[model samples]
Target: MKKILVVFLVIFAGAVQAQEVLQAGFKLLENGQFAEGAAFFKHYLTTQDATNKTALLCYGRGTGLSGNVTEAKEVFGKLLQRYPGDFEISLNAAEALMWCKEYAEAKRYYEKLLTEKPNDFAANLGYANALASLFEYEKALVFTEKALQIQPSNDNAKLSRKYARLGLADYFVKNQDYHRAAPLLESILSENATDKEALFAKAQLYIQLERYNEAEKIYQQLLQLTHGQTEVYLNLSYLSFLQANKPLAFEYANKAVESTATQPQKYLTARLGRITALGWNGKFKQAFAELDSLDSVFPNNNDLLIKRAGLSIWNKEFAHSVSLFKKSLRNVPSSFDGNLGVADALFAQELDDESKKYVLKTLEYYPNQKDAKDFLAKLALRHAPALTTHNFISSDKGGNASKNYQANVAFDVATALRFNVGYRRREVSNSLENNSANVQTMTAGLRWRVKPFWLITGAINVTKLEKDGAVAPFKTFDIASEFRLNKFQTLELRHNSDVQSFTAGLVGNQLSFKNYIATYNLSTPFKVGVYSQYYYTKNSDGNTRNLLFASLYYDLKATPVVKFGINYQRMTFEKRMSRVYFSPFLFRSYEVFGVSENLNVPKQKFLYQVSVAGGMQRIEDEAYQATYRASLTLGYKPSANIELTAYSLYSNSATSSVVGYSYSETGIKAKWILLKKQQY
Candidate 1:
């Protein structure tokens, strides 16, 4: 009995020594001296029993925490095999799987362990982390709460719960459920107001919502964080860009590029932001230079490819843009930027069907994506049926007045082909007897885009005229072809046979004209443009007219486009008939004009333009007379498919056989989409 007691005492002493060694190792691990803890446990294992379950668990954790995850996983896996169903060993094994990034397997193992021990804190927390790693954030959150309920004061469990909440919020943001995302982020901020990840996420959510000012505020808060200065500045630059403050954008981007942040991926992103900001500022050469330099360093990188593609689009290099976007798609076939970039590039090139294909593909990859749906709606508008009405009344100093009303229905009958029909009514009256006329007209038209850059259109008009109780029916037609040489150049040629109805006298005479016109326009990248027009007319009274006009303009701004221009006009008539309409032996005019317009009427709720010009005109060798013209148009779009506009114009330039003439007209117009959606 004495010998047995001594043996048992010896075993007890050895076990106590082993427990002390384990406590020391755990102390090292708790202090984050993982490498030292690993060495301590390893030394203990070398001389002691190698299979002490608690010692093995601590060693595996230390090894994994010290960055030897593969070896740690192997060790824990062997320990699990040797001690099957041992809860601590099983939990360590699962954690090792996570350390090795075997998240799915770890999740499965944790699930099994939880089924066996539903209330085990370690298993619940480990499974929560594994699920979070797998981006199963909602489930991860559930398990995180479970772990928290088990150990309400466990800081590790609390941290895991925090990160799970973050992950779930990010998932919601990615899916565009901003309302759901916002509350979660706010919850995290409520817990720790300076949490960098939560702040950044909230800023991005505001950006997605286009609450730019709020996003700017968040970014400003982020600027106080030391760890991600470059990222903060990069986002600030992007936000500036979104706000249409190009100079501020460039300034922020430059700061981002010059920041001392050393993270490689972040540095790369800052450079890209600088390049994009440069592009926004119209510094294309510098942007391209920077892009090329970066491309040489990171060849075929998807983000670089996308940036280059965007620059290509900005430079009007559509084909090259498409090619670069395709290269990005080849790298990541489901890349949202690649698919959407290709769609936009194709749309810029007027390849609508091709653009639609990629847009649909984008939607396929990201269901219910708002940008894709909006783009699809814009595309649909182009192919949908539409109706329009225009009404105007005019009066001249010669005691002549007229009223005109017109309506049209138009639709794209097929890809690149359109058909339209219209009707018009006009009434003219003057002081002289037998100088009153009324006319009714019907019209049909067709337009076909034979190529992306070329289009042909033709219209036929049937008119019934009545003057002094006499009625005359006549048919007239017009045909035109337009060529878009490039983004900034266009040419149009047109010929028309029409009744001359500028005045009551002309309408009473039933005068007709055959007119041929050519127009060419060229816009430069420097915001300068030249527009020229030439006209030749043959009158039914055996008279001919020739006219030439040209304008040179400079754009002062892009949004709410403002332009100032100088215009010149020269004209001659083969024969002058004073009693008739505008038929001068010689006419010349020069003017300087300024105009401000919001040209994106279809995309916005409000549109407007104001134009004014003052100049001098000479007719038939008379001394030059001061001339002035002004026009204003305002439009309101109540919905996506409807628009209402009102306009007024007044001109004192010579427009009649008399040397000086003045005219004014005012009108209201309405346009509506006939269908709520496109046929396709």
Candidate 2:
């Protein structure tokens, strides 16, 4: 009887100790101290059965939520293995694997759990997350919906659904179905305005659409949230560069570089931004120097190699660009940018046949590549009889700030014969009068390649300028003979009976000048060219004028991507041209110096040009005015065949022609290829 009493006492003590440990763990978890609770649960489990359901549940939940995912996965995995029939253990293990990105195994456990409790919200959310990670969006969404129905206020269920939608959106983005991706992202943002991933995605889409204002707003929001995200700053810098705000571009790029010290990937991307900003700012040597250092640091970085190739292309170093692109391809053979770079570099060298395969390859990867498609359209016109059409807003000029929108269609009936038709609408605004005038010009033309290397093209434009109680009728005729000296050289002589253009923010046809122009362009194997033009004009009063322009251009080794030129003119005007606009070209003779550069931002589907010209303008008889002008133009191509360009020009003495006073002009031009002939 005494021995029995001692045994009962021992059993009671053991039971009390087990209760104490369990209560301690539970109490620790109640205070949300997961690490401490997990340790207590682990200690309690060591003194009990390995498959104790209550102990396993406490241990797994505590371990998983304590940020110990790997060890938690091991604990839950062992629990499931030992207690194969335990429903709770299986569910936690499945979620643990899902969090750990072991999707296949997670799905297996989830399947087992679902067969037992089909409508369990936790099971459904975990399964949906696993499926979404595995790219099974459709299945994921079904499970997510079920989870939400079971627990409408569950944050995890909502997040699971969001992830599933994002998975589909990602697929749509890859397929170039931005229309589909857009609403998905917008929906997510509407639900959670502070969602960083959704905001970043939205910002990127805005950038792609060339909506800089909207993109800037989004990026600024992101920046306010966290100053440490370097990519956001880098992208802002690129945006500033695109808008010709070089100072802001440099600032943001520098910020991007300084924002991170430990993240290698962000450092490399920020370095790319710095290089691009410097190049745009005309600091090519500095940009190239940075490139060399970046290359040494991130030697096998495909993006670095591709960026170098693109920079080379901008510099007009075609062969060097090709070499860099090849090196990039060696790292990523299927790289879309690498293939496109090779094609563009080859095209710049006038190697059409060799570039064809690369263009085709680019199309294979991204069929919507605008540059490649435009090049292909040009190629089709070159090699076979094809039809092509273009609508370009082209450029803007003057104090009145004239805008010309021209659309043209051409049909190559044969290799030697082509017919073309076009329409142009010109708008001019008078700021002082607060009035606007429009001119409608209808045009038709033809091209006849009389010789294999020689061609003649002629066009006639009938202009009807209707404004404030005045309807003026005018006819302009232009004809040109193009002599293709060799594959990459051309000499053209053009005559214009009356051609309309803008001068000093005013009407170019105010005097309807007759122009005789000769242009000669020569490209050498060294990949540079000389472009020279000489023109003589006689105004309506029959007084003649002479103008000469000469420039050395780099087609394929141009650093800073510029063409610098000098112009000299000797003109005695028979009469002063017009009323609303002003001109500094008042004297008989003038000399001007200028530089221009066009840049196509790599991978951005955007092109922009910046020009600065300064000269001595003869305003009064024997009187000279010091004049300077600047212009910025940005363009976007939505597809291979469609392009839109917006431009702003400012000149006191710049964009179209030097003037006596400050003039600002802004306009938009849209171009579309209505017809393309494919040799293939």
Candidate 3:
């Protein structure tokens, strides 16, 4: 009996020591030292009873939390087989399903567990987490609330709830249901004021709603919360981009790149942001260099390809842009940037038909996408029929006056062809000469695009002229062609045969002339431009003339575009006809001009242009005379399809058939689109 007591004490002490070790392992796990707890349990189970249930359970959980999910599942599997129907074992086994990423199976098991024990906090929280993992955010949110009700202060349950709300809000935002998404995010921030995900969602939603100021405030808040992190800086850059502040966008993007020195995933995203900002600021060389560096690190990435494609477009490399976008499409067939980018590049190349195909394809992947819809609308406008009318009256310093009325209708008969018709009526009078004339003309024209970059336009005109109680009818024709040499260069050749009718003396004399003109223009990305025109005229009165006009200009400001320029003109006649007209042996003029206009200002309802020029002109080797010219136009677009404009101009640059002529004209014009939507 004494020997039995000794063995009992020895066995009891050994059991107590094992219990202490198990408690120590459990305490480590409870303290969230997952790897340490897992190592402790691993060594304890090797020499101890392998069937120790409590120790095995703690071991499984510790291993799972320590990222050894596969081994955790194996341990839990054996435990469930050994102790079937034990609720604690069953719960841990179900949780092991989640750790193994078998979310669907875990969801089913948790649902069963919930039905058996509705109030069990662990089961409720586990089910919620499984639902969240499956992206069933609505159900996850419901179960998360249930878990919270059971254990109101459970931190894990609250965190699960926060993420579930984030997922739901993102879903709503994806569907453009801002009203529903806003409140969900606001609720999260209301509780946890510094929730990063919620703040980002809120800022993005604000951007979508075009509340840029609010979005900016949110970004500033995130910047403070993150303490100048890469992600917040990148988002701030995006927000600035949306506001059309390219400089600010580039500044923030630089900050984002500087915030991280390592090549992590976030760093990759930050680099992309910097590339985009550089592109926006027209720094293509730097953008391309950055892109190349990034590609060496992460080859064939869709994001990089998209950025490269965009930079190619900006650099006017349309074919390269198309190729790059196609590469991106090969990677992500449904990528919005790929489809829309191809559409834009093709459009830039003047392949409108092919462009329309990609535009429709973009809509196929993203229905009701605003940018795609807007592009379609713009295409429709190009194909739609339009009508415009101009009316003006003028009096010159030479006692010559005129009133003119013109109306034109243009319709796109085909993708590359447009048909146009116009009518004009003019009445001219000279008080000093005691002469008057009335001229009426009807014109029909066709503009054919011979190639994507070349166009040919021809027109025939029938005119009836009545001057000094005599009426004469005649016919005229014009043919012109234009070549878009490249993005920065253009050339045009034009020939027209018409009767001169601008002045009463010319109308009375019935002067007819044929004019041939060659025009060339060069535009530089540096905001400078050069335009030159050469004109050759043959007259029925057995006289010929040659003229040259050129202008060099620079854009001082882009928005409300302000420009300053110098103009030079020289003209010579084969035979002087000072008696019949103001035909001079030689004429020359030089001028300095300034122009300010807001016609290109986007979303501007009121448009205007104000131009003024002053110069000196010489006639027939005579002394130079001072000349002045000015023009103003104010326009209003009450609707998308209708525009009204009032304009006035005055120039003393010898623009009439009389010598030293000072000319002025004022007019109101109206343009109307027959339909906003294309019929065909």
Give the top-scoring candidate (TM-score): 1
Tens-digit lDDT track of model 2 for 1-680 = 00000000001235446666477776676677888988887887787756656666777778877778788788877876778777766777777776576788888878878888998776777777777877888788899899889988867577767777777776776555789889988888899998888888888777667788998999899998775589889888988876668889999999999887856567777888888888666576788888888778777778888988888877666778899998888888889889988988877765666778999998887766655776687666454432333333322332245566666776666545778888887776655546666778888899886764677999998987766656678899999999977655799999988634443223433546788999998876454667788878776644555566666655432433555555554434444443423332444333444444444433346777777767776654656767677788788777545667777766664323423346666667665555435543
- Computed on alpha carbons, the lDDT of every model, listed in order, comes to 0.84, 0.70, 0.85
- Stretches of candidate 2 off by over 4 Å are 1-82, 92-112, 174-179, 261-265, 296-302, 334-336, 350-385, 388-530, 533-680
Would you list the rank order by lDDT, best first?
3, 1, 2
Pick the winner on TM-score between candidates 2 and 3: 3
In the range 328-357, model 3's lDDT, one tens digit per residue, is 999999999999999999888667788889
RMSD of 1: 6.7
| Off by more than 4 A, model 1 | 1-18, 23-47, 62-77, 96-111, 130-139, 260-265, 299-302, 431-435, 601-603, 656-660, 674-680
Relative to the true structure, candidate 3 has a C-alpha RMSD (angstroms) of 8.1
lDDT of 1 at 471: 87
Rate residue 426 of model 3 by lDDT. 96
Which is the winner by TM-score between candidate 1 and candidate 3?
A: 1
Which TM-score value belongs to model 2? 0.56
Instruction: Estimate, for each residue in 103-177, the C-alpha lDDT of model 1 and write its tens digit.
Output: 899899999999999998887888888888888888888987998899899777778877888888877877778
> All candidates' TM-scores?
0.89, 0.56, 0.80
Q: Number of backbone collisions per candidate, in order? A: 0, 11, 0
Q: By the lDDT metric, which is better: model 1 or model 2?
A: 1
